[model samples]
Target: MPRVSTDQLAARRQQILDGARACFARYGYEGATVRRLEQTTGLSRGAIFHHYRDKDALFLALAEQDAGRMADVVAEQGLVQVMRDLLAHPPATDPASADESSWLGTRLEISRRLRTEPEFRQRWSSHSAELTRATRERLERQRRAGTLRDDVPVAVLAQYLELVLEGLVSHLAMGLPADDLEPVLDLVEAGVRRR
Candidate 1:
């Protein structure tokens, strides 16, 4: 066998991570095994372990990467754009057609693992503070722009918004129609709307 180039190694590592994401989403963290990941990615056990120290390390890296991608997607779309898209397009019946569905599934799986796996939960909890801070900034921007209510505490409002968004994602993952989202969005908007 010839030596793999640096680029090839990086690409293979990324493929492994992508395959791991799919496996975790499909089977949850506990069900995702290195053997299964090898089958999914067609990589040898040696290659997998060479790239990632262990299953937990691989999962933590994937989870962090997924979370970062989600934040980037939201930022690129902007909050208003994301809200408009959610209100307009809705989720697809087919999972492959729905990016949000995949995201929600991944998030729910990670959340479940967080609850059941102490080490994973600790890693996730470290990221939560950063997520909350970003959310607080977004809410503050809306409030300062006079789009959201100024009466309530920004931190409190941010927490509520975060919970609402999480709930909406969970509902959507369960195949609830986008039409079902309007009332909840309306309630959130009403609570935060400028008087």
Candidate 2:
């Protein structure tokens, strides 16, 4: 009977979004159901609908939240530092063990969901642009430092790098082995490295 305050509503909305993220990551957009979401959030259908008109809207919100989080993380690390961190924490293996199958499976599922969901695709594109710009800026800084090749166009190289990364992610999702990534990374490094 009583009306909820705006802050309470926002908190409840975030809880729903967090639940949606886990559901989508586990089952994907197509497989995730309203009932499952309700179960995950412990929210009634009416309450869920009150916050989001439908599943698609809820998914879009989730995608946007993910995009923002990714941007913040990347922004904090910078490109070179991020690469170093990634290499140090290679997605294919744990610190205590060499098994990367679990990590790869989770990435594959997220990639599949991104490709199939329109909302995800749109959010990915926008987020990718931001990332590309950040990378280009970093490359320019490297160029000034005489660490990057001066001959190639940075924008063109950035675009190519983005495409290559996307392809690699897709391939990894398709069960490509960790050993197979070396050649691809080598080629990409050769192209981008200073002569």
Candidate 3:
């Protein structure tokens, strides 16, 4: 067997993640069977499993990737912008055409899994904590800058923002009207901003 370069290995791993993302998005966790994953990824089960131990591990990788991205958004733009991004890009019927569909699908699936699968929830707590930490750090920066309200503790503000994000996600997942949420998000942002 020939040795693969580091870049090649990284690229192959990324390919699996990308294909698995679309597969999982199109069909929820339970629906994305090994065969479907193979077909979508254009790689045999052996190849896919080489990168991930099993289906659950593969899904966790995808979810973790999303969490990292969300944490980046929180660190840079605040958590509200994450919700705004969801509103900005409505879920597309075509998964290939719209990134938001994959994102929303993953989020919806994560929410479902968290509620029904205690093991998954346990595995996910650390990743979830990363997002919370990012939110708190951002809030702390704002406080230092004299922008965030001083009365509320940073931890409380982070929780509040996280809850608001969950509600927004639920609203969108339920197919509720999201067309008129800018003002609502604005109010959320304002609530934490310094008076």
Candidate achieving the largest TM-score: 3
lDDT of 3 by residue, 1-195 (tens): 999999998898888888888888777788889998998888999999998999999999999998999899989999999889878865555544435334677888899999999999999999999999999999999999999999999999999988998898888766688889999999999999999
Q: What lDDT is obtained when candidate 2 is compared to the true structure? A: 0.63
Query: Against the true structure, what is each candidate's TM-score?
Result: 0.75, 0.64, 0.91
What local distance difference test score does each model get? 0.69, 0.63, 0.87
For residues 49-154, write the lDDT of model 2, one tens digit per residue: 8999999788767765654544454455444333333333344332223232222223344467676777767656765566777778767777888878889888
Flag clash pairs in model 2.
none
Model 3 bad stretches (over 4 Å): 93-101
Mind giving the per-residue lDDT tens digits that candidate 1 earns over 52-97?
9998888888877766765554444333334544456455565344
Error of 2 at 67 (Å): 2.1
TM-score of 2: 0.64
Q: Which candidate is the best by lDDT?
A: 3
**C-alpha lDDT of residue 27 in model 2:** 58
